[model samples]
Target chain A: MTTSTLTHLQTLEAEAIHIMREVVAEFRNPVMLYSVGKDSSVMLHLARKAFHPGPLPFSLLHVDTGFKFREMYEFRDWITKEVGAKLIVYRNEEAIKQGAHPLKLGVARCCGALKTKALLDALEAGGFDAAMGGARRDEERSRAKERIFSFRDEFGQWDPKSQRPELWDLYNCRMHEGESIRVFPISNWTEMDIWQYIRQENIPIVPLYYAKERMMVKRGAMLIPADDAGNLKPGEVPEPVMCRYRTLGCSPCTGAVYSSANSIEEIVAESAIATRSERETRIIDHGSNSMEDKKKEGYF
Target chain B: MNTLDKELFSAVETALLRFTTAGSVDDGKSTLIGRLLVDTKGVFEDQLDAAMGVEDKKGAKGAHLALLTDGLQAEREQGITIDVAYRYFATPKRKFIIADTPGHEQYTRNMVTGASTAHLAIILIDARKGVLTQSRRHAYISRLLGIPHIVVAINKMDLVDYSETVFKQIRQDFTDFYTNLGLIGGELTFIPMSALEGDMVVTRGTQLPWYQGQTLLEKLETAPVTGKINARDFRFPVQYVSRPQTEELHDFRGYMGRIESGSVKVGDHVTVLPSGLTSHIKEIVTFDGSLQRAFAPMSVTLTLTDERDISRGDMITHSNNLPRVEKELSAMLCWMHETPLTPGKKYLIKHASTTIKAMVTSLDERVDINSLEHIAAPIELKMNEIGRVSLKLLKPIACDAYANNRATGGFIVIDDFTNMTVGAGMIQ
Candidate 1:
């Protein structure tokens, strides 16, 4: 490899590592928000690399919406076991008991209460001063304006118009009492980069990402995976089909694509040629301004 | 991968650069990013499949490379970047993080956010549209943000028949404007390319035979970005105080911070700012081990020989090369909020690692972007406008001229009531 090329890679890695270290040093009670998605998996892997001879200094915080795919749980458990990091699952049992499914209360409200609010409650309960997320700027419009060290008020609200100027990587993680920051080390990474890194690093992921024979039902333009957690309407019928998920969210909200790419290499190849965005495949974002509205309410 | 590949990957992983692309709409910034990714072979098969499907569904011709960057549904439907989209790509040479910022005037705040940490700025200009007001504004902002390098990409050459005359004319126009703005410093390179046709993006196109210059990818790979941080002034904003009461290492007191500028070594005499306390650097600690010397941008904990009252928000610097410590300061400010910055309004001012209450004393002059004229006696600084302002701090701050040190010279104003960032100011 050319010296310049090697230098460039070194620079990116160093910057990311520095940011990760800052997250650990700045926040008093910090936690890593693990979603078991490809980005989070990569984040977990990078966290391990950031502190090489030792275990991660912070615990993993997962806001379980209670409607997640079984594969996600398996992946989450497996990662926690492998990393030996403390895993704290935050779930709003009240919302689940209230029958706040996607069909009943809509994807936005369900996610707001079950996922975003649950995470906020967890942070409050645990007195977490900072939470590290795998949110990339390329994901959405509101996300693009996010700072590496995004400050949240006591209410865990994100004010897009009034974001701190994070010049020269000198991030100000200082916040008032009861306030916190949402740190993103991979804010610069895109979807393609994530896939490429996953392929190159050979990071372990959930099997739901790979195509397999699963019971599915066509809904609108998406292929909805039929699972025990997903409730079927009167007109909906499940059929056996080969499918895989581009993004993992709630089982009912996350849609599957018709494909046969089972391996990491195959997934990378398919990702290059896929027409829809990873978010587009997810049924949860079908609502108008769902993701944006969720983010405003302190969702990562 | 072999052992050599593993080593190379490790090295590349260690060194990464974040850059932002800025310009007015129709400058082909998105297309340029698409070309970069496609040319570098960063686009995987799944992504390609999705792009092809979108192209087919929309009945659009060409590759629709912009789709790769326009990730949002609204952005795709509108055919304009509504936000700052970050795209990452890695070649065998280097890994890059590209902040693809929107070119619209309304999203100026987004541009600032993206360019905040960028080492370089790729300012795109449509060859047809010589030098627009927005282009000038972006260049000024890029310079104000203290990006080390600037690459002026003259895009859409195919629309102008790849004319050397057009490229030269545009370059001359930009050079004149930048000269007048006093913002064109560091290694500035001008490249002509057609982002739509992929000319001079990854590989030099044969069509531009007269333009004998490196391709966009080649230039990015070979660009000199080594001398970023100022080596004269050592500034470290203490983030935390690490005191392990463990058995193995009792009485271990280290001040942790990422080096913002310059370098620090063991036995170097350093002075803590704000308190004016002096001490010697006993050790430079890292996750791996202690280092003999640590430079800017490296996050390490420092063990001082003296047990001074050093804490977060306090800065440690070379005693001989101390920065100006004052309560009152002057800066060039950009108003980013809808609410105007009024004089005497108390706000929270955040510098490197410190946050203190501050109030605007006076609005010296407002800059008219189009005419590049200073409007004296402006009452309020509106959104997306630049002005010179004086501020009085409730507490003293140690800072340097932005031209000398970016880390110490910048600050952001936050509303005390709402706690929203209202404006960004650079010390003059």
Candidate 2:
């Protein structure tokens, strides 16, 4: 922290903390959506700070796709224990049993089935009126104009066109009986900011971010782990390669890039010089498709 | 070829700056944002491909840069921005959040939403058309919202043959009009550029060698943020009172909220507003540790020496210094709902964690944005109209001028029955 001034990370942190405090104060049942990523770590930290000297009022909700990196789960459990917060994990097991993996069902269909559907189901089951997502405006073009308190209807549909006017610090927590609001605290934070903040706060993220000698394979244009979750198509081959992930999602769907950066400072310096966009490595956001479609289907 | 050094770029400043773009639809607000985002490399390749694909299908000339900002499906179908879309980008110098509000005259309420939290407002103008009514209206609204800085961008310079004379004339007209409008304070800068030809946006173009000013990006990077850093009297609007009577940390009474203004250290004499109960700050608590001093915008818990019954809606400030407490408030209300704001109508007014039932006593005057004249004795204000309205609150509210501090003075009106936000109010 600067002596008298706040850096951009601190500013974003303050804004997010303010939002979280508002959520717990206004909403009936608010949950913080934890994806066990760097953004989620920063978000959890801010949420903790939002209500200090006392236990956090909200529970952590992780929409389990059942195909995450093994290290991510372990790290998440450890963090939950350390923070002494209850985590309510949700999943759509029926869809997974029906072969709803990304490789089998394709990008939108599979993400809609496992990620988006699971979240909507979880919200319905938990009766949560408000949810906090680590959704940043700089992450995707479609999210650029999303309201901080984005409204979702009974069917969990997000209409980017018709959103409440969030003026100044006044966020509308007034939702209908079944409707909910998806609030993003880190809406202004960029990828670099997340990495920088992680380094500053020493946020313990998954090991997949740092380059290591791990089992890997090539899929079309992306480098994926050889452990394909039993959905490897015909003619696919497995091999060992040194790589790291720019983003972490399901193992089969998330692409890994070749890198040597291992520490937070190294990754920050490397990511700063990296030319391609962070989402360029993810297959779901590839092609002519945008995340707005998935968001409209309630993909937090 | 103005590529900043890699080392300089890597040591990027994390200071954030938020600004709003305002103008009429044809003034190219969207195009300007797209150009800035694209030039800053904020747009990914795939996103650019989608926008280019849309342009190709339309057989449009150039890259159709506005597609980058007009993101929603309806916005694409109508070729207009309907909501306030936030766009983000960063230079090695700073990160920027752009409140890209719709430029249509009907969306002035949305413009207020975008500009209310903004530190600066970039009012775009078509050099060929000079300062139009919509341009003046946007500038007036931004000023009313207390945006500390203003940038009058004379856009579409390419269409006017890159004429310096046209840029100067528009700048002079805006200065004269704004001075008449009494928006004389704050820093005002003018620039001539084309969002299409990329004359003086992110990079300087050879076509505008006569325009000897920094590019828009440079001006934004160098704009002073220190003015807002000055400390004021302490004012912390109570968001919640935490009493986590636990085993180890018993009697942990704390008032939680982000400081609206000023700084507070331990042992400072403070008064809870509307209550005026005197106390001293005992501790400033955060998740990480205790803070010796906390400043504005920092969300922290402040424990007082006395356990006063402070709950939400009560504000804490310096004992000697207090904001004006009143029941009747005169403010500029930007009508947001379709139902016209009628006098003697009851609504819920929410301001700084305080929600109270209030009635619109009278509409003193409505401004004709086009003519800059006040329509006296207006019965009601329709959607997107700005009017001076007096509100009688059921309970007194402690507030500073919206110009003095937006966090304490800005408010919204919700319809009593529908709960829809009907208006955005700035206390005069």
Candidate 3:
């Protein structure tokens, strides 16, 4: 590579490392929120590089809604153990016991109570002052206005309309007692950038992202995986087909697209030609501007 | 793949600089972004394929460069960026994060949001329309936000027939306006280009034979990044106090936080803010190991030689120099809420390492964007307006001037009842 190109890359890396350091420096009792997704994996990897020769300064916080694909759990465990990070799994047993399924409570309410509320409760219980997330602005509308050092109230709610003006590289992470900050180091990353980074870094992702033969049923524009979460309507028959999930969310909500590409290379090639957004395939988001509604309730 | 990997690795090493593109609807902001990506080969094959599919359906012109940023279905159908779209690209020289903000006046909030964290602001001015109201407003906002660099991309040169006279006139106008606003600290470079025909974007164009300057990509790659932020006074807000409370390191006590500015060594004398408690640095600890000295933007746990009363929300700085701890502060605030900020309104004031209840003591003045005048009689600041206001904090909060220390001087006002961020203020 030319010296200038190398220098340019160094600049991006330096900024990311700087932001990671800021996260470590500003918040009291901070933790890295890991979703075991590709973006989260990239975040985890970046944190490792930010403090090379040392382990991650913070623990990993995962809010489990009890609706994750089984493969995601395996990837989560492997990553946690590989990084030697203390993992805190949070779940709202009350919601689970009350049988508040995605179909019953709707996607927004289910995510709010099970994921958002559970995360808030976890922060309160653990007394974590900040939580690092992998949310990128390119993902949704409300996320576009988020600050790098986003502040949350005592109730763990996000006020999208009123975000602190983050100027230059200076981020204000200070908050009152009981309030916490949400740090997103990869807020500038786009979907294509993430895929490119994944390819470049050779980051190991879950196999579910790759196309595979599975029994699925078509629901509207989405292909529903014939798993336990698939609440089949009367006379709905499942057929074996090659499909892959562009985005990994709750099984009940996340939709699959028909594809023959099964490897990372294939996935990358296929993703380039795909016209629809990653969220368009997700059935949950189709219900009601899913991300916007969830973000209002503090869902990261 | 190997070339791509090497490029990605190199891009990650540099500190990424975000910039915004501001121009009128027909000035070619979208086409500029499209050309940059295309010439640099940043657009993936699949992306090109997708664009081709869209092109086939619509039979549009100019390669649909706007499609590179307008990712949303609504935005694609409308042919306007309603919200800010962030696009990333890297060259051998530097990595870039482009906040492609819309030019519509209604989307002023989106522009502010995009320009807030940007280090540089690229103001696109069509040669035909020289220094319009929106261009001036954007340039003023860029200066107000303290963007250190400004690149005036004189786009649509093809339309202007690559006339140096037109480029010079427009350049002179912008320089005069920017200088009047006291934005001379940052360097300004003007380049004549056609985003549609790809002149001086990534490669040197033959059309602009008289223009002798580096391509946009070259300028971006070689531009000096603001470096060595540790020259100022050290400010580390105590995020938390880490005490393992375990058997192996039972007596371990470390003050954990990120260093906002300056440097901290093991033997330096530091003072804790608010309490004014002094202590000598004992050790600089990290998860991997201990460092002898830690500088700005590094997150590390500090163990003081003398254990004083240090807790979260407390600032640690050099013992010799300290920030002013005051209850009443004068600031320039950007009112972001629909409900205008009124005098005597109680709000949550969040400053460096601390949050306190504060009231608007007075509305000093509201800035008139078009004229750059501060109207004192303006009673209220509507949404997306800049104004000067005085705030009275319930308790003393430490602060530095926004010009000196952005980390300490900057603050946000939160609505007490709604828990929404109402406005952002820079201490005067």
Tens-digit lDDT track of model 2 for B1-428: 12434453344545778899998778888788888987888776666766677436446533478877777766788777778878877887888888988878888888999998787889999888998888888888888888888999999999999998888888899899888987756788999999887779999988898888888999888886544533576679888888888997898899898887778889999888787788999999887899898997788889999878888999999887788889999999999988899999999988998889999999999998767699998988999999999999999988987777778889999886866778899899
The digit string of per-residue lDDT tens for model 3 on B1-428 reads 66644554444455556688887678888889888877766565445545556436346647576666555554556776765667666565556778878877766666776776676788899898988888888888776766677889998888878899999999999888878877546678898898888889988879999998888887787665552232467888776566656677777777766677777889999888888889899998764578888766666778898868777678988999788888899998888778888887899876754677999989999988778887995778887788898889897877787767666777878777766667788898
Structural similarity to truth (TM-score) of each candidate: 0.80, 0.95, 0.75
Residues A97-117, candidate 3, lDDT per residue (tens digit)? 998787788776787788888
lDDT of 2 by residue, A1-300 (tens): 333556677788888888888888899989999999888888888877788778989899999999898899999999999999899999899998887877667788888888888999999999999999998887777787788888889999988766777898897777679999999998888898888888778888888899998777777678888765474667777788888998988887788888888988778877766767777777788654568777887787
TM-score of chain B of 2: 0.95
Top-TM-score structure, candidate number: 2
In order of listing, the candidates' clash counts read 35, 1, 28
Q: Rank the candidates by lDDT, best first.
A: 2, 1, 3
> Model 1: per-residue lDDT, tens digit, A207-286?
89899999998887788877763568777999999988888888877788899989876776676556556777766554
Which one is best on lDDT? 2
Q: Please list the Cα RMSD from the true structure of every candidate, rounded to 1 decimal place.
A: 5.3, 2.8, 6.4
Judged by DockQ, which candidate is best? 2
